[model samples]
Target chain A: MLRELADILQAEELCNTQGDNVQIDIACACDLMSDVLLHAKAQCLLLTGLTTTQSVYTAEVADIKVICFVRGKRPQRDVVELATNKNIILLATHLPMFESCGKLYRNGIKGCSEV
Target chain B: MSEDTTAQVLTAGRVQELVYELKIEDAMVRDVQTVNVESTMDDVRAILREQKISGTPVLCRGELVGIVSIEDLLKALAGGETKTLVREKMSPNVVTLYADEPLVHALNQFARYRYGRFPIIDRKTKKLVGILTKGDIVRCLLRRLEMNHQARERAHYRPGHLFEDVVSDKSTLVLRHRVEGSNFQRAGEASSRLKKNLLSLGLSPDTVRRIAIASYEAEMNIVIFTQGGELVATIEPNQVTIRASDKGPGIPDVELAMQPGYSTAPDWVRELGFGAGMGLPNIKKNTNEMSLDSKVGEGTNLRFTVYTTNPT
Candidate 1:
């Protein structure tokens, strides 16, 4: 995906203090921290409602590149600032939780299917 | 009478009202016994043993001044100084919270600060009235699970069904499922099962983390939004891939959908404590790469990838 397109999909831009030079290919959405720790795919975007520092930590541990916050929820200052320092693309949207995932679905993003 | 419609009607007991009643008060401990600071070492030990308490708040004339735990007493005794005053060995910092605040907030505080116990104080009077223990939170989780089970039973929803394993690897596993929209309760069951499988397969902790986060997020979306859906996961040597595709209402705006604190889940879902608008963001944060594709009316497909590198 084009860098600009990825940024647009996430509806976010790099902060002045950081670089937005990166890429992504898949996405997952969830609120349960335990489930995310267990099932996230590689080289993917994570969508979630959790805004704690641990959420970002989980992302780093999982090696996710982009983070999209669904339902207009904003992360705490520490979370946003932390993502900035970590070079993670953090974006926000006003779409409801499921609709947001649906929006991505309707666009042609294929999942990492076992078949 | 149609059984499907009848079932829907019967199972329509609102989850919102139920969870509203579950608001944090029941999870809080309302009364706590405290000890005087002037109490001798022997007296403090006796109180702890008698009360089966690990720690006690030390008060000076009705004001909390310090805290003396059993560990402190043991250390003092080991040093051959049981006659020392409780005030001398007590820890001064006392973490506290109000009785009426939400239990979730208290739990967050506990996780953030690593506090094993917290004093519940009156916000207006500044008087210690209760104690909040880790045990209290565990009890609350048990209650929540029990209530969820009761709600599921009321809905006549089966716990696990409609999934078949299609692939597996040293680092990943895949499953296929043909899902119907109305059976939302069973949606994340596949992801949950895969997580259990990963544990059984002895996937590294890093690899398991990637797989679990991606799968759960996709599974939850399928359950909540799809009228009917298919789920597929690919486990590669270094990463895991999960996809959920649905033929249902599609998203018109990808930008708005990725925002945090946003949700369209009914009050019922909110009450069930399921939808907090963190699903996608949590998945994104946990994975190394992600992509989203959707359209209005045609259908939706969501995918996730989680990568693992050998930990140092």
Candidate 2:
């Protein structure tokens, strides 16, 4: 499902990670880091549009394994380095928030509530 | 049936006019990835791998010295030469495109040579401004045809429609930014300033964020592509109007360019995380109204407006 999600999002891998073979149970998308920090489910795929290094920091604190930057929002090299050092998988996609979630949902991926 | 032909003829004529008018400067990929002449073969290979590109222009100082391809690297690797510098082995004789040349010149070159890419150098400066590939030409042509049609239809657009033509020169707070082409490091300075001004005016946080993002993305576009330009922000009591105008070729396909992930920026820019093709779309999405006016060879003019809740 991670591999399939990568294809569906046209995602580019930023570093060696837990590997794309891991199944993604829930997906949470938002641009605000505070919202993610407050509400994210553990081990969920975090989708965001903010490219700040703080996004990686927030994800690290929230215990998310994978962070996908949707709408073609590429984070800075320093941010990627931050995520890489923290052992978080970083993926970038050209898909907008609605459609990215739509594709994943249509493919049977669930929201954070299910988790 | 006759009416359809008439509409098609008008569109075709407009497209042809645009094709002849559009030049290479506007659509070429700026912020090119290059290997320094003194760089080691290993360094070149690392750059190629990191950027996911096959070849890159080699530079001595700031001038383009040559172009080195993956084949060059492969041959060197196959011969067990692992430590040679790029200057010793790069192809000195390189083909280049002048920014002022018509778009067809590049199309002909692509058809004739079928080269993967050609470096675009500024005529007076002889400095590398961008790189062009066959894909850029095809993308430009297809997008230009459709966008040119749209541009013609938008000929009568006026920004005053939103502001009721009530702007007073003394009351409007005007800000200007000078953006240098391919200057990635200093891209967001203007946007930062604009954000500060917006916040100082007591605008809502949501409104401030949208305006800041739009201004920053537009500022990035100018920095990433263009021969330096000025961004003018005219702030009124109720709205902030940002107009970005630059020197050089203008955008050929405003619609396609506004699409997310449709970036023509070089891979190196993408490597740094700026060229996601989300700049224009995000700007459009964040603003209440957006308009683009570009001349093929002359330049580009982009204007977007964000309504302020804290209108004083």
For residues A1-115, write the lDDT of model 1, one tens digit per residue: 5355344455554332324545555567877544454556666777877665545655654566677777777877867776776556677766666876676767765453421
lDDT, candidate 2, B112-159, per-residue tens: 666778999899998899988756765776786777668665643433
Give the alpha carbon lDDT tens digit for every residue of B241-288 in model 1.
Answer: 677788868878877777765777676555433456767776777677
Instruction: Point to the candidate with the largest lDDT.
Output: 2
Native-interface RMSD of candidate 2: 9.3
Model 2 chain B worst lDDT window (10 residues): B155-164
DockQ of each: 0.06, 0.02
Judged by lDDT against the true structure, how good is candidate 2? 0.75
Model 1 chain B lowest lDDT segment of ten: B158-167
Candidate 2 — which residues are off by over 4 angstroms?
Answer: A1-115, B1-170
At residue B118, what lDDT does model 1 achieve? 77
What do the candidate models score in CA lDDT, each in turn?
0.65, 0.75
| Candidate 1 chain A weakest ten by summed lDDT | A12-21
